[model samples]
Target chain A: MNFLSFGHYHHDMCLVLHRSLQLDNNSMLSFTLAMRDGQAFDTVLSRAKSMGLAVREGRLLASAKPVARAFSIQDPDRHWIEIILEN
Target chain B: MSNSAFIPPNVLPPLLQKFAPLLKRKWFRELVLLWPTLTRRRFSNKTEDYGVFKPSLVGHFGQLAVYVQDIARSRIWYQKVAGLTHSRTSDPEPHPSKPGWTLRACYMSAKEHDECLVLLEERDPSGKMSVPSGMSFFHFALEVEGNRKEDVFAFAAQQKRDGFHLNYGPVQHNSEPPDGDGETGGNVACYLYDPDWHNVEFCGAMDTIENYRARYGDKKGSDRN
Candidate 1:
């Protein structure tokens, strides 16, 4: 199993690891986690782009933690996996 | 530079042992063998002395940094209720075009190896305000004076009266832990909001402070009670 499979919400980092996928030896996978705060999403996306990962698929879904907002993102790997958050 | 002594140690396990034979494959063996050792030397030069690590970074590994829009209000609330003390307060980094917005903030510490929290706010005209949400970054609880359930409960009550209420037990008290752990005994907690409305809590097991400390040394654990 891949070590990164543990999808957890780190309070300090303010990030939720929504999903994980193990890739073949020569491939890479990248997806975005939705922000609970609507305002922080754009800032997070900009950071992701600077890392050379592209947006492959994304959508908005509602959440109910402390504040509620939708998650959206894309996978940059060849498998083209998707993650969705729904209220 | 001509000596064979520069070769890296052959530390591969049985499964990787096959790769060692290739080191003697003429051009491949001589060229690739030195690469790992060269990389090791460069890495060693840049490595930090683990024993000499800064104390601030050592204990503050997992500490939270909460950026608030209002610095003064957040500082007062954390000091008065959360039992955290300021380590330092500083201004924000300046901008190039404008005169620059000042960052007014303070650092607060907790016990054990937890990181010191750096509460910050930008003092620029464009500075944004904080919106409290249960889902937002939660405020961390400080270790309280006693470990008993009553002490935490009482402190929670006092906070409520002092106008610094936090989210603790539900009004119905349904949140109390079910009893009878050999160590835990029971659980009680209190919760409140900071100036920014971030959720903060103080909780205790029905045991001595020393007992709890001995059992969980400033690390997260499954709720025993």
Candidate 2:
């Protein structure tokens, strides 16, 4: 078996992906990525749209105040991937 | 989120509270261990982390272990779809609990992170080895750098070429509402399943807990739900 390693992206963290024989939709809910700033966030969002990927935009609220601007997309496995930029 | 979640509340009743100190003593633990049946019952009644020593933690997300039907097939799938680099493969060894059985594992890591995803398989040609049914476990995620839009797009293209598809998202998600007092913040992400049907997530941007506190105020953001 060939092993592919993507260990160069970050120094302190590694993203681990797992697979089980049976599909338990609830096993993994979602994971998030913190953008460096709003510009980078908007750039990625725009790129996703250009690729024709379905994207949903919204605001993350706390105490009825919008705390962050965000968007989401689903993978083939039906897991939520949320991207956000702090306001 | 607030540090209050990490602080345990006074859940022990007064009667049991008195014995809590005794339970921590080595001698008392030894006494309980003397009776095998009682030892099992005693430990089972307690939480899994009870009485265990803990070292200072950096709170880093580490490796994930996945059981697969075919290590070779899964390895190729992960490499093509997730862009993980293959690190090493371990020699087959005897299964600890099963006689005449052997286990082999392959380790794969992301670009620069020390953490890895491990693939384990039973080296049985008879095909009687059991793979987990995907219950009792949730999905794991990989954090993509914000500037890696091309890389993310490349990954998506490869998946399409391989006849796989994104399960969902590139969508945004928020923390719980104020009434829930959950952590405040949000993220943009997408998801997919590996060959063995395990969910894999790739995310672009997320907020830190400190950022959450900054945006929502210390009190509202600190309380983790």
| DockQ for every prediction shown | 0.02, 0.04
lDDT of 2 at B143: 69
Candidate 2 vs. truth: CA RMSD? Answer: 21.8
Question: Per-residue lDDT for A1-87 in model 1, tens only?
Answer: 001111121111122221232322111111223343333445555555677666433321111122132233344323222222222
What does candidate 2's lDDT look like per residue over A1-87, in tens digits? 111122221122322233223443222223344465677777778877888877866521111113366776655655455566655
- Model 1, position B177, has a per-residue lDDT of 23
DockQ of 2: 0.04
lDDT of 1 at A23: 26
List ranges where model 1 is wrong by over 4 Å. Answer: A1-87, B1-62, B94-102, B111-115, B123-135, B170-187, B206-225
Over B1-225, each residue of candidate 1 has an lDDT whose tens digit, in order, gives 011122212212344444433332334433553675676631111111112122111111223445454556667777788767766665555421125444444666665422245565544557743232223222344445675666776787788687753433412111122322111212454555555545565655532334434544454322321
Error of 2 at B50 (Å): 22
Model 2 scores a C-alpha lDDT of 0.49
